[model samples]
Target: MENESPDLQLQGLHYLTGAPVRIAIRQGRIAGVEPLNDPPASLRQLPWIGPGFVDLQINGYAGMDFNTLPIAPHTTSRLSRALWSEGVTSFFPTVITNSEDAILEAVSAIARECEEDEAAGSAVAGIHLEGPFISPEDGARGAHSRAYVRAPDWPLFQRWQEAARGRIKIVTVSPEWPEAEAFIRRCADSGVLVSIGHTAAAPDQIARAVAAGAAMSTHFGNGAHPVLPRHPNYLWEQLAADELWTCLIADGFHLPDSVLKVAMKVKGDKALLVSDAVMFSGMPAGTYESHIGGKVVLTPQGRLQMADQPQLLAGSVKMLPAGVSHLVKRGLCSLGEAWEMASVRPAKRVGLPFSAGLEAGAPADVLLIEWGDAGGDGSEPRIAGVYKNGVSVWP
Candidate 1:
């Protein structure tokens, strides 16, 4: 990579605020932003300019599972291109619970992708380990195979981290285990973001994990027992805790609009969104044989579920942009607010700056969205351009 910072002038409305601006894109960063003015005839026009989404919980995409060993040679590039088409310029390719060999191979594959391609490397901010350290209970476990669930082992994780070349940025855990507090402490000490998820943990255990350094809740409202006591359960405990940030899967099905509203209200600036998507994401609505979750189906309702047992949801089939549109349709937030939840908030949670896009000195991980008559709330958005570090990755 040479010292090249090509320049581009983007004339459009800011996606979040809906204010017109002329932003100078240079060297993969936002070099300048100014209110739009009469420009020369050749200036390119777009309807929206915004930060590219930063997804933290994507397990897989485009029929390729991240946990499978010996991942397809072209899978990372394919997934990167697919996600960028949907306005995702940066993301964490999540590695969920699987066998030791499988998990190592998957992370190793991701590391190789980063080592191999600069664009792919810049796109993958880091790795998200959704864990073999989660709950083993049936419903709470979701689709994770119980055979692989185990207690958190620091030495084992160190080995995995080495395999990942220390690319593991986040790790989800269940604090119910006796060893969880120490595990969270170690993770936090090492600069890895610790997120609480997929647990049957009690209020005290939850408190202990926070005290030990758990910083966020993963897919907060889901990944738990279907039933719970009203007042002192994990949901309420997590909701009330001021120190913990809450990330939700607002894919319409994972949480109702009412719940999404409440979560956004309570978390305020602390709220973030994740896809929690699986390998089967982006496939058409139909049943497909899954090597990990047996038979899974993509429903007309835009949800992925266990084909044999439709009552339980498999992982999400959503991309972050669609999730943002759903939030806007539900009237839970304004376009700007919803976009913040989808893109800005999640990136900030992982220590990225709030001015990570559309601001001077910020990386040019940006999107140009052209909405139809419904204003991006009803239909799939039109992605006219995608820039990763000021270079248009979309044609």
Candidate 2:
């Protein structure tokens, strides 16, 4: 072994195969790897090691709402460190529907945080604009404020993009508006990814949006009507379109086991797992007031809901790590496969280079997990350690 030896080395059973492997890191990136075919002379505690998870639709964490006014630059740095504890190394700080001024302010705040600190900057892959150009229908609008619901305005979006310093990678909108197709093309031409969400667009409208370069669906089973026609609904429409990559909030509350199973099978590698987590995530179980979802309650069952209407979910409280464990527990997918849905696949969709597992030249964004009775005990997989760029970043 060389001097300054990688900062650390983890020997563990492969997450999928359950075979021992040695992973080495150096200078915040994967430097080497070798199979440990035989047991070491003296063994130490080992856990499953894999690439860190990436969440494309995270809204906020630890009481920080991205849309909340007067956002501070330090908030992004704090949230990034907080998410590390949950096995997330990469995520988008999503800003949902809001007044144009509020949107620009929030973007500028987030941009300033990333622009100032390299570590904070790397954690924020891009900005996610989830609305202000979505359906006005009640159920379809989800928890986004109705007052802010309006048509798409390219000029206004350009201003927000300027404030975001061109870090606005994804935009979610409904294709129901007359200007939808053109707006999608404009966004795509500018190298931004457009997604459909909070929508009641017809099948033709959805197809047109896809034709105009809308590449994905945001939280497919959510931000829509509870009931739908058997055939031509937005859910089915997006599902059938191979051109559209779909994101699923697989935290159990957001999807039924049956639906999740079918969607995973159909989309195959294209399906991505997203937390869609709110500010209350990573917090204790209790009724908590939120800046966005007023009087939201965080239940012991891992469900975050409105206190006034227990039936309606106020975004998810489960982080991406829990979502991965839930899929494995429900027999929806294997540990390796489920983890990829939460990590590599999403990275690929966004054109980010990611390693399949620890490998030479790969960024040292990794997780050491103890797969403790996670399924039988109805508990989350315990994270033994989290590393970003080869450094222990988790408590």
Candidate 3:
């Protein structure tokens, strides 16, 4: 007789309650979760069980570059499998601003990978198109190539969507253009999420975009002009808008702790975390050539910045797990709250099945995490095990 069964039981400390739990998994879904009858001698000895992270904006990871041209045949699949160790069971492969043909080719490659590879299909929930319809201003455009930046064009977007086989689910746009409201409405009507980002728009334009179905902000405080009017700026407008979900890069360097605290307080449950990671995410600290900025420096502190201009950030190198740990370390929020910002909240924002987490009938995209010590100075949470669709993917 076989000694193993398809059904599995995972025992750990519940992420939210910190109590011992036994989670039953069967047929790729969480069958049930109940308190453990026999607790471990020390609850602290058990790993923390929580939902696997859902990063809505991941440009690349572990030396994989989705934005780079001629994406290798195995890049998407490899990236998908690589993220398991980072505790990310699901993520949106972000394709940022590039030439028309380049953008089309990138997304098409991703779509083909999803269609052909089971791992890619299961891990990639959708594609996040971050540009080509964004601002052309120097600061507002961030590191995006200004030559390719232009006003929103529905026809161009439709072509990309068709090339993606309808896999482009989220788009980041700036409402500074006159045609933004109509574009936002069309995207929303088609059941696509339109995120406001990389903008130099007036406050009223931001408000109009919200009414036109722009549901979220992309890296809210990062991609903008360094200086703005005291009160009527887009930042203030976005902060006050109750309908917009805010995405923050809590990697400790992107935004200050005070800004993160205020945004979290204002957005509450609507606030979520995104890595906005680049290809150099997992690479060792050193100066490297990048397609976005000519040369970028990855500091030992995990900050990625423009080589010549250290004040300007190149991109985030920290993964979602690191962001969660930063939030907890800074006393901005509890560990559970930080984990949810990276996992549950982002999943909920995207309407993923596992948003309810380790409940009955939820997809078993779970993580067993090891917190080395319980203190403000504790080491980052480590991914001891990662389960995707009820099957262990990482160990």
Candidate 4:
């Protein structure tokens, strides 16, 4: 019924209270945004509004693994609908280290779907290829199959680009890999966002990569060997590299609260929140089998293994909204600050032009949330409703 409303009005939304505001939606696009007023009894009692969370890295959810199967044209659309229910109206379906055929097949499928229905696809903006060009070290490589790891080959990248039909938005690779700097330059020249991760790159190599055009660090603190003497590992180097935007899992399990705070401080608005949620994500906490990395045990504390040998994070069970909440709850940042990480920051990192916050003429992609009590130590916040392109897509 809400979707049927050609023109709908929402009042009483605080809009961070920097002056009162009213938002009007028409035909699934933001018709206008103006100062707030108590319109009528009919327009009252809607939840408070904010921008919808945009995740730049999501592997899979709802028992479907993106890397496990060659993504069919309909499969991405189905997953897009599923993501809408989770308050994500925009996401980049990340395909990690896998066979070349699988990568091309999956990318082709997603690109085809987006081409068919760009808006209804819930902002399938682009594809994130995490790797094949990365370190082969067991701990550093994490769950990626080492057999497929290789040096950055420009010709191979060109082939994958053709297969993807130019939908590859970002590529994460190890800076230390041979010819990586050159590849990073080529990627930047071609408008692909290049990120450094799954790496054991030396300080000089890290600097070189940053200079070359690697602008982000994927899941900064995770995917590394368990033991390290102290400062100056890949994590530290990435943090010190001021030019690189850093994305962190922030699901409490990936990085400690203190470490998360440090990362947030180091990167500031350059920090972005990513789910990295796997196929077992929306499933309940229990033992689950991952395709790349074998069996993993999930606990109430979130996923973990012995710290002595940090193998794989598999992926995150937390979604983008929850990850943003985690950042706020841990005192790492304020609610507005957290929201920026999930929405604007990632949009900028990937060079997306439509940074659709509550701006007039922007797409009417919005979220309404009921804030939880601040004093609660472990209480979870809630997403009351979500709208994509001015239409209520989830409740």
Q: Which numbered prediction scores highest in TM-score against the true structure? A: 3
Report lDDT per candidate: 0.83, 0.85, 0.91, 0.77
Cα lDDT tens digits, model 4, 1-395, are: 23456888764454355334577888766667787665435333444576777888888887876787755446677788788767787899898887778778878777778778655245787889999998899778877898888899888888888988888889998999769999999999999999998888888899999999999998887777778658667778888989999988888788888888888888888988998888777777777666665677666666644233345455678887688778877777777788778887787777664475777667777777655442145656567777877778777
Every model's TM-score: 0.94, 0.94, 0.97, 0.90
Best by lDDT: 3
Instruction: Quote the RMSD, in angstroms, for model 1.
Output: 2.6
How many pairs of residues collide in each model? Answer: 3, 2, 0, 0
- Higher-TM-score candidate of 1 and 3: 3
Q: Per-residue alpha-carbon lDDT of model 3 for 1-395, expressed as tens digits? A: 12223799999988887878999998889999999999877777888998999999989987899998899779999999999989999999999999999999999999999999998999999999999899999888998999999899999999999999999999999999999999999999998999999999998999999999999999999888888888889999999999999999999888999999999999999999999999999899999999777999999999999999998889999998888888888889887888889888888887888798888999989999988443445676888999998888887
Name the candidate, 1 or 3, with the larger lDDT value: 3
Model 2 local distance difference test score = 0.85
Candidate 3 scores a C-alpha RMSD against the true structure in Å of 2.0
Once superposed on the true structure, which residue ranges of model 4 sit more than 4 Å away at CA?
Answer: 1-6, 18-20, 39-46, 117-122, 229-231, 304-312, 372-378
Q: Least accurate stretch of 10 residues (summed lDDT) in model 1?
A: 39-48
Candidate 4 differs from the real structure by a C-alpha RMSD in angstroms, to one decimal, of 3.2
